[model samples]
Target: MAWQGYPALREPGGRQWEASAVAWLDGGLWLHHSLCITEREGTVDVLTLIAPCTCGRGYVDITLDSEHILMDILGDLRPTHGRFPHCEEPLDCGSVHAAPRPTGWR
Candidate 1:
């Protein structure tokens, strides 16, 4: 499913990453600073999301992490809310939640 307005994590070269790549763990989840691409009307846009920490109870911005691998304890928190901190306006989390999962997703 496409989490519209959901922020992505980026690489140093400016590649976009998606939040869906994140995985839940015992306490929190691993927010991957990876890539996510979207196309509309033949136009493609890239977005970046702020990294979230498990223990701090808030989101943290990540940069220069070429490995793009960071793990934190999120506890019960999840990005179900389509509108992330970086969004200029609130997004419809409903649509994002309703969208179908990406191919090969377990």
Candidate 2:
């Protein structure tokens, strides 16, 4: 069970490092507190966390985390403090774990 993310590689290294079984091959998540999220090829050195399952799409909504606006992500949740499942913890309906949500406020 291995997952991976990568920066854009160059020359011969590009397209040379990809997993065949979706076992952390590509599209790894990257998180930094600075502007301009620069990247490269090769999933060997990036991706914050690997997918913990084989069902595809890590954390249920990992891809949409940073892509969608918070409000959009939230949709209609009463505009109040709600509990989100934490990435490190399993999802609980009543417990309200805090999940690693995305931020596009740039």
Candidate 3:
């Protein structure tokens, strides 16, 4: 589904990060600053923000319960990959490679 008027996340200092990706899985919503992989377990939602690591071999995986928390995580990522580039066309969330695994699969 195309998100109409997709929301942009603003840092406490007022910098804005446009949604590069967004999705709804198992009744929970997600917004990503960059390309991401998502998974859900019962009531918990885990998102892996891909390619923000300077090492080029690392990724940040986080579990969040609110959009604010997700925004905070994205804000904290500024130092890792610098400011997010302006998205000309956001990725279709439904097309994102969200692979749901069994609980405790690691």
| Clashes (candidate 3) | 0
lDDT of 1 at 86: 40
Report the lDDT tens digits of candidate 1 across residue range 1-106: 2232345456565654455443333332223334434464453332233433333434443332333333221222345332123443333222222234434445
What is the descending TM-score order?
3, 1, 2
Q: lDDT scores for all predictions?
A: 0.36, 0.31, 0.42
lDDT digits (tens) for residues 1-106 of candidate 2: 3623333323343433222222332333222221223466423322122222222224332323343543453453223222223344554222322333323212
Query: lDDT: which candidate is best?
Result: 3
**TM-score, prediction 1:** 0.23
Q: What is the TM-score of each candidate against the true structure?
A: 0.23, 0.19, 0.32
| Model 1 CA lDDT for position 21 | 43
Residue 68 local lDDT, model 3:
85
Clashes of 1: 11
**How does model 2 fare in lDDT?**
0.31
User: Which stretches of model 2 miss by more than 4 angstroms?
Assistant: 1-65, 84-106
User: Candidate 3 residues 20-98, lDDT tens each?
Assistant: 4555322133334343334542433334333223433323334465778767766775554432333334442222344
The regions of model 3 sitting more than 4 angstroms off are 1-51, 82-106
Alpha carbon lDDT of residue 29, candidate 2?
23
